[model samples]
Target: MELTFASYNIHKAVGLDGRRDPDRIMSVLREVDADIIALQEADRRFGARASVLPRALLDDTRWRPLPVAKRPRSLGWHGNALLVRRDIKCLHAEPLDLPTLEPRGAVLAELDLRGEHIRVLGAHLDLSGLRRRDQIKAILKQCTRRGKMPTVIMGDFNQWGRLTGAMQVFGMGWQQITPGASYPSARPIARFDRIIATPDWSYETSGVHHSATSAAASDHLPVWASLRTA
Candidate 1:
């Protein structure tokens, strides 16, 4: 069976209303219909006026939690989340810290799907070019340490079509599957979001969801790809 996954910067699920809306975000995700999703900017809380995603969002299902860095009042549960169907079993979840002044990390998880072991890593890198370079290095180091398996890394890379640090990731043997421009939800012009996979995977189809439904949801449009796992 083919494995489908997606990566999106939910902007803490904040809509134009300026309130954290995980419910609406859930609806957007349900429309995407991907088995696994890697979300960035998933905030918990810090103080008043902070964004927090309620744990009850995925309460009805078997979606497990694997959180990473936690500030006093804010935290990103898992940096990236692995929401699998009933057939997928999570073996482990690993967190990798990237070089950033802000609280940023990656979520690495091992899952058992249809008798196959899949290694998936999700992360949201820094916005600055310099910091993004460091974050890419950190991600590569962790991938190397994790051993070679069919791996998938997806999230907001903050890369604006430059062939430097972010390009280095493609050279590391991960196929970058994005439209090359995604930002400002209304009129996207930067490829800040992505979904990449190892050579063991082949890109089947990819595109940017730029419908009216998505434009009003967040500042960035969600990018998705369907990969044929080898």
Candidate 2:
């Protein structure tokens, strides 16, 4: 099976124009229209971690956010959320807490798409280099405890080097997709956002979502990839 996956750091719906427009964020999402989306900074950092994307507005779409939020008003855990096609069945969902100085964590969602189980980890690591390494190790350790399957981890990794920093943890069996620079959407020069899949999946096409709206929607442009089952 082939599917398209996207990772976007919405900056909590705050645009470069100094506006928090959830509608504009939604519009950008519609433009990408990926099968599975992993979003970072989807909710406010404080005050109940309230979702930036209106639930009512999302309900109208073919996609649905997984029930991984700890709070009723929050759409994700630690500002990380997963949105999958409504047709895909959710098998399990949980939050993965990382060792960090601030509020930081990840979400793991196991989904069933036409009987094939796919595991996805949506995470936003800390900015501190040391913390990011520890966070990546923790994420990998957690995945090791779970049953093996075709897995993908996507988010704003916040790591600058493509293969020199925290990304070094994903040694073998994992293939990291570099969809090009996605940070500083206006004139992106950093690949902060990423999508990594197990060897069971092969990449077909991948790139940054550079639509006019996306360029200004947030600080980071969305990255997407088309992958096929091996």
Candidate 3:
């Protein structure tokens, strides 16, 4: 089975110049055209403010948003979210809690695509090294417990190009699909986002998307890969 997956830190659906524009985000996603999207910092505040990428942005006949958190005034409904195409049967969403000064969580989803089961995990780690290290340990534990299913883990890891945590994850079974330099979309200097997969999936370096729309939509550019079941 062929799969298209993407990981993007929407920056709460805001642009580099601090403009909140959910439509731009939707446009970028529409251009990406991924089957499954693992999104980080998907702001969905209920009372505090309106959602930039509200439910109305997606066609009800083709997509669904997996719930991650209730709208909170303190954080303004900030959390991770998974958006899957309607053809993919979503079996479950497993939420992983990590330690951080800021609230952080991971969404693990099981999708049945053309009779094949695919596991996709999305996360946004903390900025601090100590907190990121602890979060990495928790993620590794979760991966070990999940055993070997066709897995794709992607999100804003918050690690720069020189960080060892990102390299350590790649040292494990996960392959980093995005090239170096992906943060600060206007002038990307570090690779703080990624899409990783296990050996059960074979992905070419060819179809990674880092277009100008991405740079305009958020502080971090959306990264994606086209993969085929190996």
User: Higher-lDDT candidate among 1 and 2?
Assistant: 2
- Cα lDDT tens digits, model 1, 162-204, are 5566557568567877755668887788887888788888778
The sequence of per-residue lDDT tens digits that candidate 2 reaches over residues 1-230 is 99999999999999999999999999999999999999999999988889999999999897999988999999999999999999999999998889999999999999998999999999999989889999999988988889788999999998888887888989876898989998899999999899999998988999899999999899999999999989
- Comparing 1 and 3 by TM-score, which wins? 1
Tell me the TM-score of each prediction against the true structure.
Answer: 0.87, 0.98, 0.86
**Model 1 CA lDDT for position 45:** 34
Candidate 1 steric clashes: 5
Using alpha carbons, what is the TM-score of model 3?
0.86
lDDT of 3 by residue, 1-230 (tens): 78788887887887877788888888888888888887877764445544456776766325677654455322212467788887788876667888778777777877788788888888888888778878867876887787767888888888875437534645756666655577778888877777778889998652435787787888887778888999
- Determine which window of 10 residues in candidate 1 has minimal summed lDDT: 69-78
Rank ordering of all candidates by TM-score, starting from the highest: 2, 1, 3
Q: Which 10 successive residues of model 2 have the least lDDT summed?
A: 164-173
